[model samples]
Target: MNRLDFLKHLGLLSAGAAILPTNFSSIKQSPFTELRGGIGMFSMQGGTIGWYTTDGAIVVIDSQFPDPAHAFVEGISAFGTGPQKVLFNSHHHGDHTGGNLVFENDGYTIIAQKNVPALQRTAAQNSDNEANQAYAATTFENEFSFDAGDETINAKYYGPAHTKGDSVIWFENANIAHMGDLVFNRLYPFIDRNGGAMISGWINLLETVAAKANSETLFIFGHGKPEFGVTGSREDLLHKRDFLSHLLEYTQKGIDAGRSREEITSRTSFDEFPEHISPSNFLSLPRNLDVAWLELTNS
Candidate 1:
């Protein structure tokens, strides 16, 4: 059999289904999308949760918050009788890892980047909620891989792009990739500089991820505007990269003109980029600018 036939036999390389927020809201449940190769995504409140089931075993890529995670667990359980479960955190963010305990308490081994626990623990302590966390039981420095039958699920760190512990989860056979908070679709994203997010590094990371995906690959995003929604193609990833690049350029120009931090921060949004600046969360632009300014001036 040829490669295309082999992939077809595996139920991969097909056109994808785009998920809309309204679809989830109307159902009154966290949205569940079935992809090729037994892979799917569940969007609740935080980062999108990616899951793969093969041979009665399920491997989860990120768990949203606790409340949504609970609902997600229940919703997905109906898909199959997959007694085995494992979880992975795309980053240390609460929205991504908050629901880990749901799975952890259910006997799943929670995994993450090596830097996750420290950030997770620190965020919990800072909020005085250390007892509420579902920290990762396993951590890796570079990459981690798990093979369930012929479907290969792999995760790799691209450095402090979205956060210090950020990584991308890939469902190899299905050609589906979960970007967590890395690609925020067309909405303005939270650049967690407090958690080691660097704008320049984030730009590079998007390029790296975009290159790995072909025209057929379906990408799931962490968050999107109410109208924009998540789950898109590689072009969406490049859209974010271009936005960040323009943001850096715009900020650098302001700095070169000797604008104070406050002056730069005072600007609500970049003139040319509507993709990264949301009117409702207009304040986020200044915050990202503040960080971009600091990174450019300091480095």
Candidate 2:
């Protein structure tokens, strides 16, 4: 078969294999009919972007890959009676910030962490640049809070995860926390080593958030559906810890056995959590494993 045909077949196979049985009765119904302080996950592959509506204005968190970003903003416009006041970028990744310029031109105040502007500036100067840098404005260093009608959304920068300048936004009154790319849910996290990301710091930060969350807190990950009133419980936190622990142990074992990187990648499989693995999982796994190995072994 041709390359396009092969990819199409692969997509169908993956979709069929990944189907999970759902209990319609047990499915938690959303509290609001209209989009409130929650996320509307587009396609399965699309990044999870959040929309917060308060008073008449709306605040969007992270724009999906470029084209979707425009569509997302347009969708929000239909629901919003008021204007779009702000478009908050969770990080500097293209998937998150691609729609920045578009939204900025449409009169949205694009807010992000301080490092984001610097990153965008660097990108603009780079030979491989494509992103519009004019979108970024109003960056915060440590923390900032804004009152939206009855709710207050607090933006804070933790150490780093996913990328160097990852920002986590917490809705104080709504009890909702939007963890940019910090918590990848079940998927293998993309740690931008070039962006000064450290696995240890990332894991540690997640632990801190887990401790802070309660039963009523709504946990919204960067790439997953929002969980209502179910923040990271002690048990859930332990599961995340265990996932990282296993990755570390397996990687070390491969290294001690004098296995090549390719061999290590092929051997290690997160089959228990198939959702975590990508198509081949080999390429990304080695890099991800290498990062975890370096962090654990060196520390």
Candidate 3:
């Protein structure tokens, strides 16, 4: 079947019925302290984060892992009237975009980078599953902007990092920015090679984000706690850049020394960077290392 028919068939499934909850009790249990203009963070998938703006409108950065999307929406209900307006999918990964169908069925307009729809289309065709197909329509590319109450969320695609279509949402009026999966806070980054993610390009984009912000800007990372005010500075971006640079360097050294992938994985070059190499961050290192190795060799 073609893409359009496939999407239609996929949409026929119970979209609302497919939502599953990702544990977000930690963030919910904490004080509902307003970040700026009543923006707050809701935890999902242990560390996966989403944000809620004032005006009772919600824009979930990444919809947590599958099943958690339902729980996230349900969790947010306590904070406001209900989830209305849009949901932003930072990238096309299941961890981020899996909840698209659930939100879409609930009358939420799903927004994403332009390339996200194409990626979801491919995933839907391959899975031939109801959930995946239902998610195909909620993707966009480049940049999109929306005005919520007094806030203006300007979402722009900044090359590739975690995924080819990764985008960051800048709340211009509120002086806050959501880096989607692009900024994992203080964790090892997940670079989706299959989606054309580039480590160097990712670093470059972070630099660009750092350059755009001032001390008053609040940064809502895809993961980790929200950094209010000048908490997220150029230093934070530098820290990530250093981590990626080190990973590329060490992985290249191993490859140059004729080390096998297994050998490299068994070693501890990455262990030194405890700041970015946490349990959550470590999961993506090997894959990230491999991708970096390929890019360095090809260059």
Best by TM-score: 1
Listed in order, each prediction's TM-score against the native is 0.87, 0.75, 0.76
lDDT of 2: 0.62
TM-score of 3: 0.76
Q: What is the per-residue lDDT of model 3 for residues 191-290, given as tens digits with 9 covering 90 to 100?
A: 6676788888888888888889887877766553222211365567667777888877888889889988777655434666665433333345765677
Question: How far is 196's C-alpha from truth in model 2 (Å)?
Answer: 1.4
For model 2, what is the alpha-carbon lDDT of residue 274?
A: 58
Model 2 C-alpha lDDT per residue in residues 214-297, reported as the tens digit of each score: 776666665431221113434454455566667777878878988766677564458755545443342256668877666656
For model 2, name the residue pairs that clash.
Answer: none
Model 3 Cα shift for residue 61 (angstroms): 2.4
C-alpha RMSD by candidate, in order:
9.2, 7.0, 9.5
Ranking by TM-score: 1, 3, 2
Assess each prediction's global lDDT (C-alpha) against the native: 0.76, 0.62, 0.63
> Candidate 2: misplaced stretches above 4 Å?
1-45, 123-127, 224-238, 252-266, 271-275, 280-283, 296-299
lDDT: worst 10-residue window of model 3: 11-20
Which should have the higher lDDT, number 2 or number 3?
A: 3
